[model samples]
Target chain A: MQLTQFLSRRRAQKAESRSPLFSFLYSRKIAPYLFVSPFILSVLVLYLYPFYSAIQMSFQRVLPGQVFYVGLENYERVMNPIFFRALQNTSIYVVLTVILLTVLPLMLALILNHRLTRWSNFFRAAIFIPALTSVVVAGTIFRLIFGESDQALANQVLSFIGFSPLDWRYEAWTAMFLMVAMATWRWLGVNVIYFLAALQTVNNDLTEAASMDGANALQRFRHVTLPAIKPIIVFLVTITIINGFRMFEESYVLWESSSPGYIGLTVVRYIYREGIQNNALGFGAAVGIILLAIIFVVSMIQLYLTGAFKKEH
Target chain B: MVHGRQDKLISAGLLAILIGFAFLSLFPVLSLLVASLSPASDLMRYGLAPELFFSSFDLENYRVIFGPEGSRYWTWYLNSIIVSSMLIALSLFFSSMVGYALAMYEFPGKRFIFIMVLLVLMIPFEIMMLPLFQLVITLGLIDTYFGTILPLIVAPVAVFFFRQYSLGLPKEVMEAARVDGCTEYGIFFRIMVPLMLPSFAAMAIFQGLISWNNFLWPLLVLRSNDMLTLPIGLATLLTPYGTNYQLLFAGAMLSIVPIVILFLVFQRYFIAGLMSGSVKG
Candidate 1:
């Protein structure tokens, strides 16, 4: 190793002594670009182009290959009654789901991360099953559970408790609540895993020091644990809000339409139904832009709330 | 963090509350299984009873799920496996290649490219669902397995995680290889990739779980009933045949089996991948 290093060094010195340009040519700059080219090519094709096309298509009218620009009309149409209902439903979905995503997972992390639990691993794997199960099947199963009869699980259970069996999905509010339950079931474990991972990074020293000073459990969590996992909390908050807007499949499964009062509906489903099913491509893109605007606004709110952009907390 | 017996009881009480949350999480699924297995005779006999498990057990549900023409369940099971495996293979190579480019070299727009990837990671695809579906239509990718697999292949999150892991690797290893007149591609392929085995495995497991479970995009694109993936197919089953609880539960059970197996085997890597992209293995 020493001899090889010595020879390489001597050769490099000789090359350097001969010509500076020779050295620059030897240390070529093209390698990085070469290594990174494939990735750049893919991003342009798959991501950047699709995004650009969405904005462009939202304004253009396509008729037998000739295109004409027709802007604000699409947005105007979107401001009508149907879109308003979807927008209202979208807001409700976001608010309800964000709560479930934050609390269920965070609390689950606290429980599962505890040293006192002997069956933590079992619970972890079991809880994760809902997330791992094919969403289609989960949707199918849930649909059956909410079917009109006392045949449905929720109705059956309620009936057994002296309440009459109710048609779960026929009623709008009950259907929305059930949708929230489905979303919560499928995601709680994945979020808990993230929180549990962050929990590991919580400084034992800080917690111990707090306890040594006779601080109680809630005090320690408030002063130490919560602050420590603040970044993860922010991330979870961000994702929950984003996912809220993205929900679609279960709604389509539940309601079977792009109709008014899609209680199980969310914003993404509206776009899919508009663009694909209804063939109103321009109108759908306008709706998508509106959803995007909300997501971006919520993200900024989170950034302001967490103060992470300030580097303080 | 210290808890006296009273505090322990209090925390334990809180933990039980969390357990109650867990039970709430588990209740619907258990009840699904309960309702599915509840015989038509029983529903006909007592109507949907809440205390389902305490009431009875039956193998009829399992039998219905396994029967080929008995339900459309078998077809959905087969479709899910084929499509998910194809996605797993496609993403492993594509993401690794993307990761390799970001890891092994520097270039103009390197920072811009990285930022673009981060932005993509943050912006959920539903925002662009309209145009992307339009694009897929133009490409004639609808109802095809490649259609389902193609969009998710160029994931920005995988690249971000890989770049993070790669940046922490010692630079001199690549430098030494370059000094030896090894082509940059050769150095990356031979040395860096072999060393990144753990990350590759980690990502493969992660993407497999995702692709296996994905429903929304597939639902939008796949029109023919034959092209239906498991979730889409399962949804269709319930619409017509769902009144038969045994067959529906049976179908649900089959969809879960392969995923549960994959999880049991790869749960450790699955857990670790979610935790740290930086972990070596």
Candidate 2:
């Protein structure tokens, strides 16, 4: 990014030596830099620098003031079984969340596309309210709602419906379900908006044609509407996958710090605990870099699979 | 059309589900409001209350969140406003700059830069979290507003949004300005900037929300109690009287206010930008 800026500056310099028209006109090139410079400067200071520093620190161990390089040792430790539990949980979540995110939103958008369900604005505003509330607040509310108490709404409903009152967040096997519920609550509406927008592009004639030919609503959706929003679904999938890997706040707030005591943690959150809180700054940085690589690989695979990046257009 | 009653049934079914979802999405806020207002003895475990949902009768919790006793929560809101406003200001600049660069100049590495932006869209704070922490420590920016405001300003998503709006703009207008001998930044500020008012407004709301609503980074970097943002302040509030459901609800609602009002007032721009983000994608 910098090299281009330098080259562009030199180009501007060359143009400045020409006729006044060219010099004065081409000076506009500098504006883009000026326009974008604040961001570049901020990112360089806050984003790029921290990114580089973390890598450097990841190589070196931290002990009080002293720090030194140990290379892949941190990576090795981070990949161990205890931490891999978090990885395993994260992997399952990424897959499940991506699929549900794609399907649920597509279905909701289709059902909502009906003229009878014309309160799109109202439903949208309400459903998206969770997205606005802080995860801390949302998690706390739900944690209280789902707390291990007799009056808990979920357990009350469960018992009312004839099932035993269950420990929602305390178990090993069922914990991811609670996590998924919270994750779903926060994100499902986000995709609903995305799908709703994509739905606007589906020609009404297409769905109408299906109905004219004795097609049912489900059939019309499966054949026509689904195909129109297929690309959007793919986009949502990729986003969901990335978001799943980045899941931290919900787990952090829900688990209240330990996260199965880091067992159900994300690779990113795991790195956070190891690097920042534990003061293994270098090891943490290395973990961060590796996590970056994992994300890069996963997303690349997704893009390649979906063929959404096709150059045919 | 197939069967009138069946159609009605399906329609009602869908409505019921949406209504149910709206309740789930909104019930937490209602509960928060109720819990915040209730007295210490009434801070019950977890039962639905008619008053919480039906009545808008509460002021004690609100007072506590903003009163001298709730100074910490109020400070968090102030910090959040400062940080979010700064972020909004910076993102608008960077986005305009990057957008203009991509729009007018045909740089050789433009494609690569665009690609980087796309890839970075996928690069959530998870990958950058630790590195960011280290970066802050090295720069002595930990606990400072700059640390929180700066990184968020360089958002690729916002940059892309700016670029898209800039593309639809008539190039001839800028060309006309060029003929008049306006400098690069001159045309940008006087010409393209004003023309892109809708984009600016959209960005102001989006960036504002991101800054105001953020919690994780603030939780990580900020140390001093005074430096806390609304979310952090709420967390602090959690500890001293963790048992105070009413107080917790009050603080949460306070945190929710700014973004909610912004979202309401700028509904059109916000929705337009949201729809635009999808179409562009």
User: Measured against the native two-chain assembly using Cα atoms, what DockQ does each of the candidate structures obtain, in the order listed?
Assistant: 0.35, 0.49
In model 2, what is chain B's TM-score?
0.87
Candidate 1 displacement at residue A116 in angstroms = 3.0
The DockQ-derived docking category for candidate 2 is: acceptable
lDDT of 2 by residue, B1-281 (tens): 66888878878999998888889878777766665665522443443343344555667776665667777666777888888888888778777778767766675567767776665665567666766766677789999998876467677878888888888888887676555555566567767888999998987876776677687788788999889887776665443236645556777766787677767677777666665455563
Clashing pairs in 2: A35-B97, A36-B97, A57-A282, A58-A282, A60-A68, A258-A261, B35-B246, B36-B246, B76-B229, B76-B230
lDDT of 2 by residue, A1-313 (tens): 3564455456556677878877655554444555555555656665566666666776778776687678778777777776777778888888888877787777777767778786878888888777778787776667656756665666777788899877766776567877787788777777888888888999999889889999987898889887788788777777788778888777777665575445457776777687677877767777777767777799889888878778754
TM-score of each: 0.87, 0.88
Q: Candidate 2: where is the Cα deviation over 4 Å?
A: A1-26, A39-49, A260-264, A309-313, B1-3, B40-59, B239-246, B275-281
Model 2 C-alpha lDDT versus the unseen true structure: 0.72
Kindly report which residue pairs in candidate 1 clash with one another.
Answer: A136-B231
**At residue B145, what lDDT does model 2 achieve?**
95
In terms of lDDT, the poorest run of 10 residues in model 1 chain B is B40-49
